[model samples]
Target: MLLHYLKSSLDDIDHLIDLTKKDIEDIKEANHELVFERTKIKNDLVKAFENKKSLLDNELIKMVSNNKGMDLESILNEEQKTLLNEMKIKLTELKSVNKQYAKFVVIVSEFYNTLLDKIFPRELEGYKKANRTPATLLKVRA
Candidate 1:
């Protein structure tokens, strides 16, 4: 009976290890998606800026040809202005979401490290000892 219980415990540990591996993989995938989304959002912002600049240049050229002396800012159509504002808002949102994703990744990484330490304690201990040395106290005599 005792032997059966020990076997079951080992099996449970194995299952937990597998689950932890899957969780780590999922976190990595989420991190990649966040990076990709951020890049895409940045690219979209650049494109929007270029479009806005082009519109302003065209308006300036039109004003110069017409001899009206109009400013570029006053020439933006309502729809174009709204689109630019929407893109800016989306860019800010993407940045915020990416920051949250980074925080989640850190949490997942910490959990993964904890699991690794439990599964391979000797290696984890060695790494911890090498990286986290105790601070020495210096005695100063005046």
Candidate 2:
């Protein structure tokens, strides 16, 4: 029973990691819709994982503690330990990917702001006429 729960939790983490990778791809493509979809999927997965964690902590952990006369570490067999370790590694990778995605977003935002500033100077008002000649017009010969 405890092993089953641990395996399920590991599977959930693997799925989450997969979704995060997809999210990174969406970010690279600048696909806002896909990113939003990925975010929703991730949020739902998180809620499911929370429920699973509650069950593990409240039921599986207690059962293992009572039967094995030891904590979770002592109860887990070699395979379960390996799965747990793999889950930890995947989680670390996910963290790194998320950090990279955040940095990409910030860089994109800065670029957009810079472009906006160049397009609409702060000194120019909506009613004010620009004194400078247009670049496109200057290129045309009379």
Per-residue lDDT of 1-142 in model 2, one digit per residue for the tens?
6567667877777788787778778778888688787787888887887787787677655757577767777776788778767767877887887788788779878988777656553445588845443444236576
Candidate 2 residue runs with Cα over 4 Å from true position: 67-71, 116-142
| Best lDDT among the predictions, by candidate number | 2
lDDT of each: 0.51, 0.74
- Model 2: lDDT of residue 136: 47
Structural similarity to truth (TM-score) of each candidate? 0.39, 0.67
Alpha-carbon RMSD, each predicted model: 21.6, 7.1
TM-score of 2: 0.67
lDDT of 2: 0.74
Off by over 4 Å in 1: 1-72, 122-142
